[model samples]
Target: MTQPSQGVRRSYGVKAAPYGFLLPAAALFVLFFALPIGYAVWLSFHRIEVKGLGLGKGSRSEVWAGLENYTSALTDSELAHSALRILGYGAIVVPVMLGLALFFALLLDSERVRARSFARLAIFLPYAVPGVIAALLWGFLYLPDVSPFHYLLDALGLPQPDLMDGGPLYFSMANIAVWGGTGFNMIVIYTALRSLPNEVYEAAKLDGCSQLQIALRIKIPMVAPSLVLTFFFSIIATLQVFNEPTTLRPLTNGIPTTWSPLMKVYNDAFTGGNIYAASATAVVLALATFVLSFALLRLSNRRTTQGATR
Candidate 1:
């Protein structure tokens, strides 16, 4: 047989190289993400049945639950309450966090801003901290005895309100998320701002537009994609809030084990020992996330297309 031509070998190598490079990533994705999700989905439709007073291996068996778990999760008042709490939390978090992120990004991009580098680093520093650690740190700051705000109120002879109770608890939790997240979102928006053509700003200036006017008109519109991206992540993160409230739980009675949907899933799986129910709730939350994310993206795309057409 004739040896393969150099061109044939080269073409084969070119075709094979991309797959070779992707192999590791594909394997890891399957092993870690895809397999786990598939397993959870399988577990969601199963329940463990106990027999003979649950005493031996033969006493326990896995049985098909069909949509029983889903039905239970859907009808669960605790789950519904948790869902509402998260929605309320997201209402406070997504807007306030993204607004501050946008403001800081625009401020850092402004020509008159001082200590720009230091300010950016300071804002983004909290992003470096782990979510659990950030929650713990903020939890301490909310404590009446240790909190500086409480100390200030004492000094001024005013009533010091509990930060971890009632209406204040929502803001307390929101504040932790905002503080930890705003910096990262700001960096994303700031990077997008920096990518815009300077000519746009110059043209606006030549047209007698002030800095604020240029920001409101040109800068914001230019970075709308980044804003949408940040908003999407913020909404997801707000919905999945667990660490902040969980950490604060020990400090106050306001936070329950099922304070958020994700937390409710956790409680069902571990604390309540109902893995099937937990899996079903997790699947529901995941589906809701996908639906909301797709809807938002579609809306954003429609708006973008309409804007471009005009």
Candidate 2:
């Protein structure tokens, strides 16, 4: 048989080029993400059965557990409490973080703002700090004996409040999240704002709109997609909160071993030596995240469609 012509070979090469470039990424995704998730799902459906004295190889065997692990995880009271705590934490972190992000983004985009680069850096600097280090730093600051706030309060003869426990603890945790997250979200919103056409702003200004009016009526609506993106990520991060609380746990008793769902998963797997249950709980949490994220996207799309129609 005659070999294919060079023109046909070139066409084939061009057609295959994109997939060739994407091959490494696709391989990495399958190897790292897909396989691990598949294994976790498999593990979630199986359990170790201990037999006789549970001392020999034959004494323990893997057996089908069906939905037993999922049921136990769902009915777990500790998990319920942890979920409630996350809801409250999300309530605080999401709005405050996104609000500050949008506010900073708007400020940075403003023409009258001075030292914009320095101001942007100052706002985003906290995000550069590692979460564990930030948590530890703030944890020490929450201590009355070592904190400057405590010293100021002492000099003023004022009562010092314990920030590491009770109601203050929520704010304590939320503050860390807000500090770390706001900057990243702000950059995203700022980039979105910068992409907006200057003609719209010029027209609005020609119509006698003030800066505040332009931002409120024009900039915000134009940047709704960025806001929604930030909101989605904030929700995901709040749901998966582990580092800050876990780091600060040594400083206070307010945070439990199962403070968040991810924390609970860690404690169950390594600490409790029950990987099966942990896998089930993790799967459940992943499902919940997917559901909530999907719902938010749907709601956002619907609103965007409505706005476009009008």
Candidate 3:
């Protein structure tokens, strides 16, 4: 074969360099994400068949199950209830968390705000705590005996509503999530607010606009993309909520073993010893998350495109 020119060799190297750099990430994705998802899907379509007493090696074998598992998962009452509960939970968490985050971010970005570093740290400290630990800490506070709120209520002779049961339980569960999640979302919004050009604010001020007007008109609209990002994350987190409810379950009668869909999946797989059913439930949850996330992204893109055209 004829020798390749130096330019051709350099061109080959240039073309291959990006792939070489991407190899590690691509390999990691395949090994961790893609492979595991594939296995879960494969397992979801298969079930164990037991012959006779199932005492021998050949007694039990894996067999194709088709849509049986999916049908069961879809029609499950527990899963349906859990889905409804999470819908209520997300309704509370998403708006409240994002609202508080946006509020705090606006405060932090203000000129007159004192002790900004301390404020930021205080707001963000909850996020640094592990979800399980945060749940435990909040769980302790929710108990009537140990909780200061209950103590104060008793001292004032007010009715002490149980935080662990009935309608109050929704707020109780949501509070832990809000307490832990608000800080991180606040930081995201704050970072975005900080990135905004100061000239816009200056122009708004020069036009005799007040702080509130500047915030509503300029700041919020400017940081909308960040809001959308935090909203997306909150949605995903709300869908996959497991640790908080699971950790708090021991402390409360309100929380069942299947309080969340993921909890149900865990109960089915390990506690119930039905991996195929769990796998099916998991695949369904994954698909729902993907659909919602993509839909949100598309909505966001549509809005952005409209804004650009305007």
Q: After superposition, how far is residue 117 of candidate 3 from its true place, in Å?
A: 1.4
Candidate 1, residue 184: lDDT: 99
Error of 3 at 25 (Å): 2.0
**What ranges in model 3 sit over 4 Å off?**
1-15, 308-310
In angstroms, how far off is 83's CA in candidate 2? 0.5
Q: Judged by lDDT relative to the true structure, which candidate is superior, 1 or 2?
A: 2
Candidate 3: tens digits of C-alpha lDDT, residues 193-237: 999998999999999999999999999989999999999999999
lDDT of 2: 0.95
RMSD of 3: 1.9
Per-residue lDDT tens digits for candidate 1, residues 206-276, read 99999999999999999999999999999888878889888889999988889999889999999989889
- The per-prediction tally of clashing pairs is 0, 0, 0
**TM per prediction:** 0.97, 0.97, 0.94
Model 1 regions more than 4 Å off: 1-7
Report lDDT per candidate.
0.94, 0.95, 0.95
Ten consecutive residues with minimal summed lDDT in candidate 3?
1-10
RMSD of 1: 1.2
